[model samples]
Target: MTTAARQPIVNDDMHDIITHVNEGHVPELLHCVKAYTPVQDATHVQMTAVYEDGMELEVTAPAGLSRHFVAYAVPGPAHEAIRGTVGEAMKKLGVKPDSRVAHWCLTENRALTAHFRRLTVNLGEDERADWRPGYACRFDVPGHEHGRPYTLRRVSGTTAEVDVYCHDNTLGSQWAEGLQPGETVTARGDYQEVTPDFSAGPALLLGDETALPTIAALLEGWADEHPVRVLLEVGDAADQRYLDDVHLPAGAHVSWLPRTGGSGTALREVLDALETPPAAVWGALEVSAAKALRKHLRTEYPDADVRVTGYWRVNEKN
Candidate 1:
């Protein structure tokens, strides 16, 4: 790696202050690293190398420890870039990058409805076996160069189930639709748990179909003493059947809204009818609806902890 040495532009007085600051408080040093951009590499480069404009990594393998160099497309922060580069390098070396990368065999794939499909996968007996609620995995499918993320709906021992919505046959959707039993897929994760803090008081959960898995996870940790309310919007009445087998909290009330045309009209109406502000509000929905919900929560219940994430953008191709 080649680093250009440049002198600081600070004058004597400023330099003196900076030196004093550094005497006892040194700024954290970032380790320089590099990662190849996804969907671009066609051929694998040799690991043993030295590049003028790249990062050199010390890799440990079964054979022995060796040095590998991966070039970066652009130069910037090292800490932010190293992990991804290391992950890709590990993949090339046919090794699991970390606990986040797991091998899963597809055990079952069945259509739940015309729009939804239920998939069950058998996991390995490693760190990935300790699956938790609210954790999602990203699938690196064969043809889909850029992976896709899916939330796990259920996990039992070495088995996990994922509910996939297949309304459109995009790259990710197409790969999911054709998945067969015994087929293997790489699952990587940056697990997220966005459930509201119930310790604040009673909670209100609101979202659409995409939020079902997350909502189910939140319900698993539900307490009977605290009141909980769920407001969900679905395409039709058929979509509500999945809730029949779910374990809801005691005193929990669920209201289902069927979308006629508008995005968040039902959610707005539901909020307007609330007798008291909830302790916290959590939701994931379409972009416009999520924005509207955030605005409403900020204006009406300013003191409440509100989280609204836009899962899909309107008329925007991801």
Candidate 2:
């Protein structure tokens, strides 16, 4: 491989601090370096490295007491490269390929054995479902966030569908956009356990594009006697066409709000303009916006059962 000059992304102040601290234990730290890789998301790439033996270092300042930096080193040039390379290397070293990334507290170095043990234990108990199989049905829903899409899957029995929005701009949209038929993605918890009971009561469904598929599922499953109202925010008329093409239940009241500015802004406008129905309200959108609407519902209609979630954020990678 051709070696290019490695331009450090860290600033002068950061470099000085790292150098000053590393100088004291550079040889030992370098020896402990086991693997490294680059982690790439839609927005950015970050370097995550792991150290075998671990290192101890402290940071000092002119005005206050210094802080300590403790982490394992993964030996690679950049964050993305390190992530890829280290993932492969760890597998060869007999580390479980599905191990979660170690969390580094800014205090002291923790033992690798302990960290790996905890990770292994957690993986055993993790009940998250894989969504990669459903990626084939994923389709972009224009207007809310740039390059974002809605993912869909057919569930057995219950027409009631569940959609998850993780407002951080990382996996949800990226996965939706890149999803192909037969691809698989994992969800880290029991979805059925957390899904609220929607049977009985007037239903007001509010969500962005991400929630569209779920809303459709609910409508399909809902009894004709149940009065359901849907408030959806999309990117444009094209999105409306895509949604309209989906077969929804008969008599389901649907309203579309085109997101002209920010994702949350459109949601706020629609909520303010609409008449509050005496019913159970399911409001899901981007994380920050969902929080805002939940607050509004609490203050404006205290008696309503409001369910809100931040589906995704604009620029977040994960």
Candidate 3:
């Protein structure tokens, strides 16, 4: 639970930083004093203190010595790189990152079905007491620049469970398949809620195998006030196990589409044949298919609230 006030500008860190800059970046400090402050006749400048929003400076002007502060272009309590485009987008928006990049050890690795493996990590008493429900985090994958995101399924005490389906040859799939007990994984920031509201009307959710975990998570917590239809396209029938334990509500139905022709073939056929347009649409699939399907949905159902994400692109590393 490190916060900006707690860890951003610690005394030891500040001392080291001040020493480094005073010794090396003196010219830059002088430039800052001249350009930023009202000290136009300043002769010499030295950095005195550093704050999260700005740096305090000791300016030597023609008149006398005075103190001034120069604000940082980007504020500190700065977060290092976060995984996934969602994190990048957050950074671009200047959203203060959640300081939760921590190590979680592999406690349990068991199979849920033919291709799905359930991984449980020990988050310890600190995390258990602080973790909020509906927060999903990204785990660091070895050799990958930005690791993949896994849906945090459930938490009991200090342990959290996440399911990884490994039927594909993706890097994340292999990484999950190779994980063993005692090994540690880095949990990146938790920014988004895995499940979104699809309780508006007769909503349509179309997803491929990659979206299985999120789809199941979404359905389990559904409001169940509206009619919902789920269409899942899987390369093999075994992937249906990804949703084996998901309980569908009274007005909810799931249809499994087999990949016969190619990606999105079955989904396209189904969408084209639908007589009544849905009020809302959500889909996660390969890049081209997701884009094309979004265009089709926008064209046909102009009034629908549609959201389609390119989970993965064809012929590209996952």
Worst 10 residues of 1 by lDDT: 24-33
**Candidates ranked by TM-score, best first?**
1, 3, 2
Clashing pairs in 3: none
lDDT of each: 0.65, 0.44, 0.70
Candidate 2, residues 181-278, lDDT tens digits: the string is 33323322122211234554566788876666556555655654656778888765455543544567665678888787777677677666655453
Candidate 1 residue-pair clash tally: 0
Q: List candidate 1 stretches off by more than 4 Å.
A: 1-99, 315-318
Give the Å error, residue 275, model 2: 3.9
Cα displacement (Å) at residue 297, model 1: 1.3
Which RMSD does model 3 reach against the true structure? 14.4
Candidate 3 positional error at 284, Å: 1.1
* Residue-by-residue lDDT tens digits, candidate 3, 1-318: 212232235453465356546654565556556556788787887777666666677889889998875565443341221122224434444555556787888898888777788888888644436554345667788878778877777667788778886765678888888899899978787644422246556888887876776677677767758788889998878778777677877788788999877678889889977756788887788878877787788788877777666776677543
Q: After superposition, how far is residue 8 of candidate 2 from its true place, in Å?
A: 48
